[model samples]
Target: MNTSPPTAIVRGATVRFGDVQALDGIDLALTRGALTVVTGPNGAGKSTLLEVIAGTTPLTRGTVDRDGAVAFVPQRTALTPRLPLTASDMVAVGTWRRAGLWRRLSERMRGDIAEAMERLAVLDLAHRPFAALSGGQQQRVLIAQGLVGRADLLLLDEPTTAVDARSAELILDAVAAETARGATVACVSHDPRLIDTAAVVVPLDGGRIDQSIRDAGRGRPRCPA
Candidate 1:
């Protein structure tokens, strides 16, 4: 079994938005260097779970312990046509965490950004206005932005939604590569293509984890307690 320590752990996690409970006590451990796919119906708290792990949303109750830097690629981003930002410019934002504002990007950082864009197949769209790109193209660019950081933990929400078949394939390939490189990846998706390949599949319902299926046949163990 893959007995390595978990990359992140969430215990007794509960999130309430007024009268609505987004998550009911959830205990989860994300295995390091594995692809974890969170699947559920709409409003099943898939995105909320990811947000909790990303530390962007505070839990109403519970605790989360995580390791290393994180890179989150949200499902959708709205950019006005007037923004005048190019695709490359959007991807370069990933480097800001390390390079910071007003600091020139080092050669390695620049190369990382370029490599990320190329892996997502958006390198050719580098000079195009971000707002001018198609939905699939924009999605790929956002993913590239996330990848450029080379964060230890990568989280994505519905990355393949509304994307073309080729784009979806490319996105999946890129995330899989991240896992191969020992980065922990958690993706919220309904796409069977992703679930079928995930080392761990987590299904949620009514804001609770229904089950965690680790591909034991492949020698992967269940989420740690």
Candidate 2:
């Protein structure tokens, strides 16, 4: 394992959307190589947390400090249709921030693209048109793209949405594998079972995280109130 300390911190965080308080007083610590799953019912501020961490939305309160680059996979796959781009091309976009705006990819960049695709089991899809894939396939491709950066932190919002159990398991297993490799993963899911693999399970209700305890084997990680 990397043995590095936490690379991301979400402390006393809160967010408001007009009349709705998306998040309320949330404190979270994501250490390197830990997979933390945030589980809650609908309207529990899952996506909001991811957005705040990714810097797409401003924090209404508190702080989220990411020590290194963070990769985010939104609930909706950000695949562009009719663009004639392959899955490999989409993954390559993840490296864009590392290069100057006008700079082209070097041989090393291309190698990274291939490696990321292979890592996520999407190498066979590398030449396939991204838009032509099914929902599950697209989800996997997006995950592959997100991993291309080898980011210190990865935030996924409902990553298993619309996928079958087999596909979902594959995604979750891959996420766990990444954690073992020393990357911090913060994922949100409405499914309680998702928390089974999480080192930390945070349940939120009414915009506040519920006081909960972790019990991995029971399939119910939340404490009985």
Candidate 3:
């Protein structure tokens, strides 16, 4: 067991959009450096849970204690295809916080972007316009972008959607790389292969987690209250 502190903890968290409750008192502890897969049926609020973990959505009730920077890759539909930026340019956006305007990318920044793209197997698409790529390709680029940033918490919503087996493996490898670097990875997924890589499996239904399976290899995980 790593025995390190968790990356985030949700206690009685609730998120309501109109009458539909996206997250209904959801509670889960995202273990540091461990990959957690969020599984649920359609309209089960899997996306909403990721948003809450990313801190992009305000909770309607209860609390979320998050520790450290976050990187989020939303669903493909959330990615804007209208941008004229190339795939690399889109990935470089993750480094913009440090590169900023007028500041040329340092060697480290350039390497980070390259490594992220390479891990996602999208390096060849670096010069291609994001909008011109296929949906699977665009998803890979978005994942590359998310992985390039300095985030302790990685929240990816259905990262493997439309991705081929090889591409999906590459993405999983990238997520593994992030975990090896001590980041907590949380992904919303329906893919069964990912279950083997996860330290915790949370299954949601109608906006609430019905059960959570802690990986036996990690011993028993203590989710803080």
Candidate 4:
């Protein structure tokens, strides 16, 4: 069994928006190279959990420790429409945090962008305008962007939404590939089938984890749900 501590840890997390509790006393551990699927009914705080993991939302009452760089793909596409950038350009943005304005990208950085596109099978579309692709293609491009910096933690919110079944499968396959390469992934989705590909399954209800299942193939047996 892999004995390493989790790459990301959430302990007694809680979030509230007025009277409604978005998240309540949630605790989770995402191990390195592990794929964890977050599934539950609507209004279950799945998205809120991903947001906290990515550092987009501050915790209301507890703690989240994200040890390495993190990446996020929101449920809605966040591409800049007026930027007139290509798909490759979008991928390059991942590195901008390291080389902000007034900095030039090194050849090595450029190579990483190229490799990311190729890994997602979007190399041919590298030169395509970001706004010219369909929903699924755009999703893949965003994923490539997220991976450009070798982000250790990736949080995807409903990545398969609006895409065809085949496209969704492609994205899931790529996610599996990322996890195999030592990136921890937490994906929020309404689809329960994704549980099959995950090392752990977390089910949310009314803002808290209702059940947790650790896949038996890699880790010690978890208490029955």
- Clashing residue pairs, candidate 3? none
Residue-level lDDT tens digits of model 4 in 91-190 = 8888876567558899988898898888777889989998888777788888888888778898888888888787777788778888888888889875
What TM value does model 3 have? 0.90
Q: Report the number of clashing residue pairs per model.
A: 0, 0, 0, 0
Candidate 2 matches the true fold with a TM-score of 0.85
* RMSD (CA, angstroms), candidate 1: 2.5
lDDT (Cα, tens digit) per residue for candidate 1, span 63-91 = 99999888988777534545579999999
Count clashing residue pairs in model 1.
0
Full ranking by TM-score: 1, 3, 4, 2
**lDDT of every predicted structure (CA atoms):** 0.87, 0.77, 0.85, 0.80
The TM-score of predicted model 1 comes to 0.91
RMSD of 3: 2.7
> Could you give the C-alpha RMSD of every candidate to the true structure, in order shown?
2.5, 3.5, 2.7, 3.1
Sequence-dependent TM-score of model 4: 0.87
lDDT digits (tens) for residues 1-225 of candidate 2: 234677877887899989889999877777688777777777888778778888888988999888988898887545355557888877877887776456898899888888777766788988898888778877887887788778888888888888877668778777877787778888888655556667667777877778753464656334212
| Candidate 1 global CA lDDT score | 0.87
- Residue 217 in model 1: shift from native, Å? 9.4
Q: What are the TM-scores, per candidate, against the unseen true structure?
A: 0.91, 0.85, 0.90, 0.87
Candidate rank order under lDDT: 1, 3, 4, 2
